[model samples]
Target: MRVTWRDHSPHSEAFDDIYFNPLHGKEESLYVFWQGNLLNEKLAGNVQTVFTIAETGFGTGLNFLCTAQSFIGQSKEAQCLHFISVEKYPLALTDLAKSHTCWPEFKSLSDQLIQQYPPSTPGVYTLAFLEGRIKLTLIIGDAASGFSQLSAMVDAWYLDGFAPSKNPEMWSDALFQQMARLSHKGTTFATFTAAGAVRRGLQAVGFEVEKRKGFGQKRERLVGRYLQDNIPEPTVTPWFDLPSQARPEQVVISGAGLAGCTTAWALAQRGIKVTVLDAADKPAQGGSGNPQGALYTKLSVKPTLQSELHLCASHFSLNLLRQLDPEQTFWSECEVVQIATDDAERTRQQALINEAAYPQEIVEDGSKDTLSKLTQQTVTHDGLIMKLAGWVSPADFCRALLNHPCIDYVPDSQLTELTYQDGMWIVQTAAQKTYHTSTVILCQAEATSQFVQTQHLPLKPIRGQVSIIPASVTNQKLNQVICGDGYISPPFRDHYCFGATFELKSTSLEITDSGHDTNLHNLAKVLPDLAADFEKSKHLLTGRVSFRCSTPDYLPIVGPAPDPETTLERFAPLRKDRKWKFSNVSASHLPGLYVNCGHGSKGLVTTPLCGEYLAALICAEPLPMRKPIHDALNPSRFLIKNLIRKQI
Candidate 1:
């Protein structure tokens, strides 16, 4: 059947479901037997961790909203409640708001969900709600096709598809069989259908099927349990042994930019002493000292692994920034306009907007006139406006993060070398002073490559220079951040920061007249009215230059590093034979050595989240993101992939 969004407004006469029939006052259908009996009590009472519930059809999201409300009332002290559902034909954002008005009792829960609902993508879209207590995973696609690729275990089943005669695909034997494969032996399933094929298919997969009273004018429904019938249990992967606990006293970090300050804060929070060493006279004096940086997010039309990971990190970082002191740190809720320079780029943006199912409030179509008004300029092209995007001061945020009580600020101290001896990582300064700690984190930007241990790592230094200009009263009228070929921030600190020149071949940190002229020329293209102010800004264009350390793929290298040769030799057999097994194998990591570097251009958006992720890994806490991100940022990934390809 061709699918469309179901109208769920209480005021609208089209909203009709027997289970929630106000006229009949709540009757039981097979839908109740399947959803209420199987899912609610069975898996909830048994699971030790946060219970996650996923559904294929989220028509009005009644099933998920109801499940959340019930779980909150019944399961107290449950670590978290996760309700994930999908809808191929999602309603407009306004329609969702109207539908939610029907349930005033669930207003608080619905409001939070509505606020962070991601733009619809073709694949999985994960959302965190209730201050990270509840998670919602939505996969908008065909039920059978979507479930087959989903990698989550369900404790209970809610089989509430349309009637088998009307929507046979929803209740097909193949679908039931797939569900059987996805469910555990003790999984209880309930459905409003008592069809012979449904029962037979479930029973064929070892479930004990039974009939029950149906809800809402329906005569009968079915509920069943998967019983073990002497089949062998699946083999579980052996858990890796935990690393030996280290003496948690102190750590020495060799940088004072965003990465170094963030790591220092993470260590300080865990009751560990932190000494941040840097050659600059003050913190954020390097690449992170940009006057204003944009929180840019690159999203894809299809839910690729990279897009998924970025969505999670973006939201996490946004929320983390909200909890900081906004006065001392510069952050704005202003929108960001990602103008399409050409038709091809516009097409890509349109495709992403449709797949993303982003709220209309967050992303909207813009005309050239609207763009001109938003940027306070005369002319502009049509494009997509991202309301959730904004700008922040990288230097100020770094300062705020490093303001913790347990951190010691040791600026003007240049780190010369790091030596691991006698169970301690000794860091020596240029003045012959030595500081010994059990853990050492390297975050000194491009200077990090100077260390002997990380000399072999592929890190390149690129110089970036941003021009500072005093914004006139007219220039200050610009309300939002604009991005075309280059980016310009809204007026801040009595001046607007614009025209950042990127040079990959430049080695000298000295500010040049040519670079300054290049910046002014670039700024003129975006804001032509500011031509008169350009010369005055040029006269005041005394700016700082810093080198950004970046990797080839643009993803940062985090986590532990092992000896390269040893890692290659150990994984060699697995490369030759995919099924090869090795025993008593251990990672040849440099003990207690970790690096959080190579953030590149997206440092403002990716760095803070990276710091949190590194902290979670070091402390052995539950990660903020799923498994793929953890793997993407793994320090050993390059070595392992190269070894597998025999290129190492």
Candidate 2:
């Protein structure tokens, strides 16, 4: 977003108005939003543990910064401040830091925010501060569209945007309707505008709004609470509805790889006890054991479910990595240069950049010369340089996530049977040991299908091999991670990890010589000089092989496990007439059973975000993604599709 500065004050160029009161921006934000919504008094009490706030325009983040600081010092009990804000034109990182210079008291908190700020792009960027006590979800999109996609119940609202006359479209009935849909009976709202159109628009959407004395030069403002949920919400297929589960006290998680460890970390952060059962001797012995895995995604030319997931998950994972390793020792932000290896791929890359399918900060056009210059070596393709990606140590990440005191790791305990009685699941291991919990989450990739409830899940195993070799003998060092059909990670721990061959037909876990041969051949095609160096030292060749569980569609499954017998019987009429609406009946889910698997090769990018989504659902908190995207990742989607086609 372009901003014009007038004597150290921020002004929006698109709306042709000032961002806040120039002389009293801090005081004005506190008076209008903090006090208007009664945040201090509400936060000081122990009635609620999580106080969620939603805002319209996050022009300079003035309201958010004020509330974050206040919540930290004023709250008597430990509480989390969940702030969600929407913006179409997000400020650039440099400009955001520049704008915050006006407030010196928030230097420490503002610095943390700057460190976690995401690129100016359209995605859900959630940042954490004060050790998870505060979470800021920044949705970079239109005000109404962003709110419509969210599935949340807001406690307070900061309805601060450009003046109603300046940005008339944002202050319409459509926006207010969404506000009412996301608000409960006691949800409160405060706005800096007192326009009659806004008051009437809010009243038309079930909000009891009234005018109050305005801040500084302004004469009047509006404040109110949602009296009821009278606004009509869009209809959703009942089968895709998210089933409610109680806040789990003790949880059992199978497998300790990325899926398991990440979920364990998410739960442990909320003061929940988790037991991670692993078949192997320790964590990261499965698909997550690779020495190095690149944090990247191959964006599709056309927008598809996979592309949407990749775009959003990539952003979420990057932020997660930074939070995990702030010093950048186990990971590197050197960026991934995804080369378009052929003319067809080059054309697709051009289309992706030219059509502006993504924002400029996420990706840009690249040339062969640019690739060579970035890597400091010979390269052979023009590709899209992805700014939001790099490489990470999957093994280290899993270990760090499982290091929490709240997580109990069980080794060599392969799951044997699961029995449900008294509303609790009993998990029995091969060692004849049993554990009980109210909730059981299956993160054991393909092994989840061993159970009757989740056996219908269409999870397939794809074998992959990554060959690791010592540093290249070439004088030039690999400056960044590079990708073609496979990826090559930069030097770390005295070795250059690269060459992951995708084998669809192979199931054996042995690292065959032929697998290394296929990887070397592809490396030769992409970078001949590096291949020659590796060829000179063939005796040093070594690799690891693992199987990635994936579904027919590439999206990861993250939701309740549906009971196939009852769910199939309930929606059986869809096979006779595809237009049939089973709106009254939701899918029958196995009580307290959830599964998070089928990530395939994108586990590094998709696991953490999906884990967060599952944790939010279990805790009855706001979701972290769009509604359609959440449904697209549902495990029951394939069942519904198959029933409609009479294939199951």
Candidate 3:
């Protein structure tokens, strides 16, 4: 049966499954055995967490969209539903939108997906929806290879491919073997094909295959479960012997910057009582206290893994801010303009606008005239404007997270030391006052080096200063956030904030004349009209300086930090040969300990998602990102990479 795909419109497209004989109607193609069983059973009710489902092929994403609609209709308390799908050939974003229109019921869900679909990349791409509850991890690659590399357990599997005959590669014995390798004992699977080869392949590998009444005009379909005999059990590492449950009801978080407050909010949501220990009287007195900051997605034309993560994080952060109260929290809808001064940047932007289907209405090209009108400044160049991007008060946002009912704001208390005794982490202040808790999160910015456990971790402290200028009536209330060599936010509360000078050698928190002058010089490039305002506000130009903690590769250090020596020894066999199998080995994990720092300049965009990621890791819930992003942000990535690099 030859299938016909219709590129219905510039924004829509659809393809019929030639092998699937629909007995119902055109809509019957949407029905598959796996989808029916998943929808009928209340699997999430028995589990105390956000359920996750991973798929092999996302040709049209029909299976995922259908599952999302069903999951939403079923449970209200289902904290989150994560659907991760892999596809080698992805359609254009506009084509996806067009194809999605065929399903009226899925319009709302598809609309959201089409709006935030990431740029095409070879590695994993994550998109968050429904306020971070529903997440999609789309890995654009071959199913067999992708599934083998994936690190996730699927509750239900939609084994969708072209057909046993037409797409034999998808259902080959090797592929089924890989699927069996990834399946847990009770893992369930369903497919439309009842072909003898498929059944034998599945049975040969551990699945207890069963025939079911087919959907539409088809007479039969197949569904099955991984049996104990064929399914291999995971080997428990010595480190995993540690308790996996939540330590206690209480935790002590040191530091009150964005990192600390975000961690506090995450813990509070989990019903964990939190006491924030800060040296200063208030939160955001550190690196997070910047008066104005820009929020923009970073993309690379070469399509690297880092770029993919940033794109996902940027969109997730933007959506998260939208869910919060604008007035209480410090945020603005000021658009971000990425000026095209260099050919390299211009080429990158052009590729992004052409291949990636961003929320178009939110990002567009601005002529010099349009730019001047929007920014209220003379512009000599054209640039791409991100309408959804803007600036936010990092300090105010930190305060909001600390305001939760489960949080106890402990000010003027600085952490002096950390020691584990009586199965509790005791955090002592300089005055000898100690606070005890089973779990402790270090979010003290660059001061994290003071902690014994993380002292060996490679983190650098770079000082940065931001100057404030009074908004003059003629200062032109800039309508959008502008950026060139530096950036400036629209006037807020009678003051326009700009000028951020980065000095790696400087460590003092005191503001300096040189730092102020450097900021003023940088600010003149974007808004030369403000040169006079700089002079007027130079005397009134108060500034704050803080240190930003960053890792070598720039990815945040999140998830469990296993004992370094133990991990190095456990996986030492891999150092000898690249053929070592990780199938049976479990990575070691430190008991009741994790880290969520080293966010660098993307603190606002990555921190909230990092909080969610940490919660998921603690709960052993399904991960929001695919294996690559998880591995990228893994706390031990640096250590493991260094070991691998050393062997070479």
Q: Which model, 1 or 3, shows the larger lDDT?
A: 3
- In terms of TM-score, how similar is model 3 to the real structure? 0.81
Measured by lDDT, the strongest candidate is: 2
Candidate 1 wrongly placed segments (more than 4 Å)? 1-49, 70-78, 123-126, 140-216, 219-286, 298-329, 339-370, 380-384, 395-457, 473-476, 558-563, 570-596, 607-634, 644-646
lDDT value, candidate 3, whole model:
0.69
| lDDT, residue 91, candidate 3 | 66
lDDT digits (tens) for residues 1-648 of candidate 2? 899999898788999998878788999999999999988777765476678999999888889999998888887545788899998888888788998999999898899888878767566777878767788988888999999988888999999889999999888788898898899887999998899998998888788888899998789999999898544343557777787877888899999999999999988887789999999998988888889988878887766667767777887787788888889888888778888778888888888887787777778777889878877778887877888788888889998899899999998999999989998899999999999899999999988888977888988888999888878544447868888878888888988778788888988888888888888888776777888888788779888998888888878888998888888998899899878865567768888999999998888899988988888888877888888888988888989999988998
Model 3: per-residue Cα lDDT over 401-459, one tens digit each: 78788999988999998887887777899867988777777777667766767665778
Rank candidates, lDDT, best first: 2, 3, 1
**Candidate 3: deviation at residue 93, Å?**
6.2
lDDT of 1 by residue, 1-648 (tens): 122334443322222222233332122322473254654455456644455455545655666677776666666564566555656555555666666676777788788667656555344554555544566766655677666555455566667644565556666666666576666667677776788888888888778899987776678778877776333222221111123334367778888998888778866765568899989989998888888888766666666666655655555456556656535248886778877766887788879777755556557777779878767675446777876567888888888878888899898899998899998888999878899887888887767767777765678888887777677534446778877655778778887776577899998978888877877776565556664466655677666677788887778876665566666676677568645556666556777787888888777767776776565456543344444555677667766666557666
**For every model shown, what is its TM-score relative to the native structure?**
0.71, 0.97, 0.81
Candidate maximizing TM-score: 2
